[model samples]
Target chain A: MNAGHRSESVPNASRLRIAVLAGGVGGAKFVRGLRQVAPEATISVITNTGDDLWLAGVRVCPDLDSIMYALAGVNDAERGWGRAGESERVSAELAAYGAGWPWFTLGDLDLGTHLARTSWLREGATLTEATARLAARWDLGVSLLPMSDDPVETHVVTEQGTMHFEEWWVRHRAALPALAFEQVGADRARPTPSVLGALASADAVLLAPSNPVVSIGTILGVPGLRDAVVSSSARIVGVSPIIGGAAVRGMAAQCLAAVDVDVSAAAVARHYGARVDGGLLDGWLVDTVDSAVVPELDSEGMRAVARPLYLSSLEQSAAIARDALAVALG
Target chain B: MNAGHRSESVPNASRLRIAVLAGGVGGAKFVRGLRQVAPEATISVITNTGDDLWLAGVRVCPDLDSIMYALAGVNDAERGWGRAGESERVSAELAAYGAGWPWFTLGDLDLGTHLARTSWLREGATLTEATARLAARWDLGVSLLPMSDDPVETHVVTEQGTMHFEEWWVRHRAALPALAFEQVGADRARPTPSVLGALASADAVLLAPSNPVVSIGTILGVPGLRDAVVSSSARIVGVSPIIGGAAVRGMAAQCLAAVDVDVSAAAVARHYGARVDGGLLDGWLVDTVDSAVVPELDSEGMRAVARPLYLSSLEQSAAIARDALAVALG
Candidate 1:
């Protein structure tokens, strides 16, 4: 075994309550792999609702469902969005009614999630409750959670105008250069008790290869969340969403620039420097191509491990996860 | 013109700014026919929001959308509920999660309306504003007004337990014999000013063939809406939802029974009654089968007009509307 490998055996499946901070696409892929490798782990995903917006009155939680669908084994692998057999007739009708923001194809089946969540939220339920109810519907083995019960919108302050994350990402195709990334209502949003409790009790915390700026960043933006994760006994590890230089999906590079972080694995590690520096990462996993950044990441106090984080196959992805756990318990 | 028809040189279109008090299904169909006959004339449908409920946090307005879809030319003709070309994948998923009542089949596209309305309400918009925004999206020319912006739910007190209108309508299929009908929050629900204005400014007023006890009756149940309609200068007319001894749609007869009204068109007329001992109905239209009850209605101080009120076709429905107008004007 490598020097980073630990002597402690992995936690039992039924007793393990692993919490993951996730975005979409990359995160969903990693989650699928995680579920395959650790089927018994009671996974709790604190998803980024920053990308969530009221599009024509439906509470569209893209990231949450991406993970939910991945867990439910119904996610669309081709588009990397929505369910595999999803229909868009409802979305087309929504477009016809001039509800706008048609770039995001809300499939008819996917719309069920939004409709249920929206309805629950309207009936005095928090976003947390709505999300839990939706997750329960899919019989999702792991608990799915919104980072905060309160509204915390991710505003991409572009040169053109301050627009919602969906407007910036989907509608505008993230074409406009972002001036800054603002997490609106972050100060007021409280970290869900479940998220905090999971952090406190977790033996290991995994940061899925979600967008560091908008996805994971938004979750950390919830006032007490970052602190809770940092102060926890759980060893923190993150898989770089950036494989080499470009993001797997979304404008992660642009988001990194807006947040004043360099678009490199080493910079991402340093950005999430140490669990002590308001950064929740202690172990950082980078792709083989970005192995050159190991020295810099180690210099910043994170145990840097170079592994194939491309997640091209479920086995490859699980191997990388095993590597992350190894480094965390070194 | 027939002897019952009040022949005049009055331009039908000019005198057709019809204000309709409605619930769902039957009410919507009459409004549909009304729109077909007088598309150019301003039609303002004041729907009963007393039947409105926040299920799973989505603000579902059965009457509002029923009328809106009917006017927008997309109501489901066969099922007599929701929009045409609708999908219930969302409802199915909700059921799978053990979430909201699933019997109603809230269509995916239709759920979008509720989502948007609920989201707007979350962002601090009243039901009126949300409904206006929703109608604007459909580009509906007819003014669709909620009886009250405040939350007013229609509750059916049955032997088993009191349940929401949607629960009673959808879950039980109105099977439970209702002990009484209660419009919850009606005492607190003051009618919107727009409703009174529409009623006063309307050239003619029509009550769609909705249930007198729970549909139109629910709207009239709002604190001041019934009083405004009763006192309005506009000529009032009502089409019978009940033809012979059976209702065109829904459990209108059962609802009438709950309110101690008989199941005949004449009974419907008497339910509206004479305003001060004989005043509420200026004119009442009954089907050919109920012609025997017309003399009884006239004796009770209600102007009764016998016509073929079974609205089987667009043209036939408009003919009934014309006859009702003729009687009201006489």
Candidate 2:
């Protein structure tokens, strides 16, 4: 095992409930590690819905699906997202009909999840309820909860015009320098009851290494979600998505730059700010390569820890999870 | 060739303007033959949209697609419908998600047509406009017009409950004894300007060998369509779907039985009645096997002719079309 400090046999380990704030692939991988390390602990995941959009008349929640598929062990490990053994017949057909973004491909098997979710939503079920129904299909160890039931699409304002976050990310490959990220409907979105309850009663809150600006930031932007994490007695710890001054996966650097934050772990920690200074994070975890900034973070009233944060495998991911929990517990 | 009197070399054959009222498979096959026989003639096909339904949030126009695919030479000859070499990955996924009818198999290529139609409809395009756009993708050689731009669903009232025509036809295989076929929204539906114009200006109007109760019957039920045909100067000729006291394809027998009409050529001719007596048909063409009904039909003010009406091949279908035009002209 690659775990530097094994916490499987730690006292009250089974009863330690952790709530995770996650986005898509990166977040899903981290949550998978957290589940493995704390097998007995009740893990509640609040997923970002800002990336969600309606494609070909079907409601597609990319982040929720990625997390669900990863937890269920059905995710395409090579592609880093979507289901294994997937077919893109539906997506090809949709494109032939000029229905959705021709650049974005939806696998046939993945479309089943979208169709079911859209049907339930059309039948008056909330996003949270539909997610529960979808989760029931697989033995996901974590309780998956959407940040809010209301729609909140992330629109990226570009030099040409405003486009959906998915269009900018998947279509343009995020090459279009985003001027800003507009969380449409986020102002009116209220945190679901389960999300609020999970935050209020959780032992610790761990923010996954997702895009801080679009993923974790969008979740925090939901009405009353960030305030709940701030007011609760639980220690909130966030793992830096940027490692060695570069994003581990996806275009987090572009997103951070759009918000005028330096693409470094220290700058990200400061961006979340210290809980003592009316910010959300009580602790911050960064890669050992950026260990020089630990004292600077501590001086800024935010407890910081440096560790091997590369989640190359399940064991390596579990080791990172252990370090985050240790920081939160301290 | 089974044609009694071939008219391919007849004068004014290329200039013959024919309007056909049609349904799905049987009608599409007949139209395919008509196009082959009179390549230069202007053939206007008014397709029934009664069998159309919204499946998985996509508007599926079964009859229109059947005709389009057949005329484009992409139809599965063996299945008598849908695109050849098509996959059902999308349909299988939809079923797995419990989104659409599990029993009804929608081929991937067929779903492309539905997606296109639905997308266009959602973007403020009428069904007529969408059909025109879809038809532009294929050199169908004939103009395809929907009976009405408005929605008109065929519902079957069975002993159990009133169900959509697709549910009765596809799911139950039409085994359930239907009390009546309700053309929902037909009363409010008006024939498109093209439909009325085609009927008014046509030299000959032919009724294809489609389902009488649901196909031709439903089209006639559209508020002004039957009236337009009735008031037109064109000679109306109908080719019987029934031969040797049974329907050649589909569940036309069940539909006829439900409407209290005997499953025979003579009975169907009577069902349409004579145009002179305020009915839809001026000429009724039946198979030679049902020759005994000719005198009875003639006595009933309908000019009836007995010939080979089976369309087993393009040559045979063209022969059938020739007979229909001859009857209209006689």
Candidate 3:
């Protein structure tokens, strides 16, 4: 993927209501930029719960926290996860007690949120309710709705046997060749009312350039979430996490390989397919490095366009957001 | 009361087995000294469980932790509680969420212990079992056993209504004018087998200079605990937290007032009364300033001795421990 920094800043429409599907780092950065460009727009994010897990008697939602911290401006911008100025005293102790993933380090500040959420959950509050209470502490401009209130864990089946997605990603660094990716409880989970409402009432639905096989893929795996996006009156557009023949970030290349898809922008668009041909995408935005496939994607009725997709700064990211909105609103 | 630290350092017998009933700061200090004096003795501390409470979804035993930290050499000596080299970032965040005691702050290093203990308890470990798991992490010289495995909270009844003991002692600084002391659920609680066995087999039993009204009193209130102490053949001795007409530290004077006991060494001894007179104490160690009551206590069939009761230093505390042991062993 070429990390060229070149793009024409486009003017955006005012106050357009939009819903976004997101995962962790990449999604957080994209949404932060999207909010920068459309500061007055009513934004709703449907976060994937597939990465949530019970560790040390506390429920940790990686994607949910990543997005929350990024939006609140308390996120570690350099590290791309957890709160800024965090200490690992509690996590170090937890590891000493052999209670959690040693590799999955949770900073003390992040642990506070987990501990508070666990308290609510233990006292019978659903995931959605607990998240609301946590979100209330921050002035996150957008409403964050989990894809479902129910527990849905993504697992990777490797030759070494199946493990939680975090263990595969964080612990193993996806070194173990995965046989399959399964959203363990997604078959029983339904989209929360807020998620459905966000999709139904939005003018446009955007998918952040997160790993499709695990993040967005896992969110859509929730029983009724994909159907709701497909049925929504909003035009559904996606930004390719991949540029050229590799992932922009994370272990998406390995995930794509495991799922038997070529690590290319074209393969991913076809994976989402065209909404006109009974798939998810109405428009697909690819980075300029992968512009050669734009016409083929357009000819396939997907209405593809290419632009510089490097999120090197807030301004650059906002420019990409403007282009996505322009194409969706066109 | 006696500013002069005048006491003969009595030689302790090697490996004398003893059991101690203790509470927070005073108890922790005394135990640390006791371990120093009798380095090879089998010491088991039956910590007051009434100070235990559920805070932010985690079961926190202040007494157990205090003793454990003290014995492990990790206790904060300056403030007399929590760990040394602590941080409060997580605690500040928890307060922002409105989830825990705003006044009683838990340091991040201490929070690590709480989180691990909570994990064990949630996984079906009994309070006793959870405590054992925590104790295993430290090289604590003495065994810190909770008085009982049940949820026995000490609540203070006041004009402002009833509140947890920590709220009264820590938050309000015991200023609410407590009407009565309550050991809630102690009636349904049974001391663990370890606690009973420790008392049954010990060469002597000790009441640390913790607040008699709430600390030692709460342990004695546990169902069958007082009976075990009285029935044990071991000579039971008590070191007065009260000296002259004042408590050594803490809000013991307020607690003593709540229990209608005059804040004097003689008064607390009378409150426990003489074991021969169907009460708990067989021997009592009062400060040299309160030596005037010794003859009267001796005549009442309870051996009374006076020593410097202030635990101002490790050497001073060890001298007090040696004096208490001498009186019991006589």
Candidate 4:
């Protein structure tokens, strides 16, 4: 049942190849820290595209840009999304025109990325191609790959009606009680070749501490994606988005409730379940505050470690990434 | 044959309904001045759509925005286009992304218009519908109607090959030595109902001093558009873009050369010819420097007058508009 038993252990950072499934803000910060800890290691990020949407006729890939901006050092850490020194002139005008959600604003700089991506996509280039083109602008230490070239927009079913995940997350600020989460087109969407290749070639695959229901959940929801990760020779590890009994960031608690899952680190680890029993995680990383769950997870045939998961600073994030890699390599 | 033969003439500005054919900078300035002279009159501008193009996945109607911004008092007078207090943050990023034209930059506020328009278009709104939505944002005194809802992009045939009018004008600065100007969709592009209705109900139709070969030329090129103007009860008048054997603004001289027309006031009026001779204009306004052409135009059955053609001030432009109306209503 030990995932480490099948693969040759990549003991040194220089020889390591890690593939990560990530989303916005929280995921981006984690990847940034991962880069800090393993500067020489090859990191390929399979970014969640369920957050991608059409705003004012332009394609905005939220998760992909988050990782890109963070890695390029242009991301606004304080605001949590978008580039620093960003202006809202265009978004203000969009609001005036009654186009795009007034609540969910796109900065002028971020609009540039949307414009480029939309233009390329309209010109017959796939989402993966558009992603590569946008990523090329930055000296992002990691290669960014979209989960799929196909549209896989996450929609939330509220008691009233079905709305886009962004409308629920951004416009309502997750106030809407989601009855269910649906990745529309996930049934037909195949993970991009780059993503599959990254998984196949990886020495370790990590599920970043992003929203498990929409971000990491949507990526794994792709047709062949879950099978690729579960069957890959690489040791698969997942860092819990929950610390103690609360979400690290975003609306992970609300999301967990929508899917009838308890809001706790051990509960989420159990939700992903153990790979030997036909679930995702070979190892699970929980916060030190929830160390009680470590023994519970280990007893379930999954390697478990409790570490300080707060990404308060670069050093802390790097330490967490280092801890996660250690648990996977072990 | 005199245009003044039309039965009813509303001398009172408040009761007047004047329609004007217009393009970007020159036309916007002329219409602004026209509004000053007839502030109480209902002005309906039939804007040239020949300059509209898809840039970075958004429909950019250069002439329409120019007039809208100018009328709204948000125009950048120094730059001759776009809104004042503009920022190029979006454009700089666009250049880095290699999306839009490198030479022709769109300010952030201006991009808002393109985004709104493109969004509406993608949502099944016609160009006319989109223009109405955009114009509704500002208290632009005049009704802004596109020449046609159908695409009518002006293309320049050069010694090398055909290129978009904007590329020939903005990127090449009209230095490519245009051999001919072709309004690409003019043959199939019918005048919008609003534009035709504006002309049919107008007291007089004034031709703003925009480029003759591209702007006005392309508008008139629309199928049945010229017929609507000629047959309508409205007296048709044209303000010359030429002065003292040279173009008043833009590459009107180059555009004239491409069509083998001499760059002179008399030559331009003759190019339009007399309505009695089955041409577009019933009267013409020329700069005082070229007063010698007045007698020549009159003898050729065209009512012509000389005036200060410079739109240096609102007062000066108002004076020019008044004089041009006098010639048309004689």
lDDT of 4 at B72: 89
lDDT of 1 by residue, B1-330 (tens): 112222322255645667888887777667666665565677788988877876765678888988788767788877777888887777787777666766666787787777667657877888888789888866566788998888898899999999988788888889999889888888888888888888888877888888888888888888878778887787788888888888878889789888888898877887887654745777788888889988988887777788897767766766776676666555
For candidate 2, the TM-score is 0.95
Tell me the lDDT of model 2 at B37.
71
Each prediction's DockQ? 0.39, 0.47, 0.63, 0.79
Identify the runs in model 2 with alpha carbons over 4 angstroms from their true place: A1-14, B1-15
**Chain A fold similarity by TM-score, each prediction:** 0.92, 0.97, 0.94, 0.95
Report the lDDT of model 4 for residue B61. 94
- Expressed as tens digits, the lDDT of each residue in A94-192 for candidate 1 is 566555366877887787787677767877789888777777656566778888888889998877889998888888877888899888888888998
Local lDDT at B292 for model 4: 88
| Clash pairs (backbone) in predicted model 3 | none
Ranking of all candidate structures by their TM-score, best first: 4, 2, 3, 1
Ten consecutive residues with minimal summed lDDT in candidate 3 chain B? Answer: B1-10
Q: What is the Å distance of residue B65 in model 3 from its true position?
A: 1.3
The most accurate candidate by DockQ is 4
Per-residue CA lDDT of model 3 for B54-86, tens digit only, reads 877777789888888888888898987999998
The per-residue C-alpha lDDT of model 3 at residue A181 equals 96
lDDT of 2 by residue, A151-212 (tens): 99999999989999999999999999999999999888999999999999899999999999
Docking class of 4: medium
Task: Output the worst ten-in-a-row residue range by lDDT, candidate 2 chain B.
Answer: B1-10
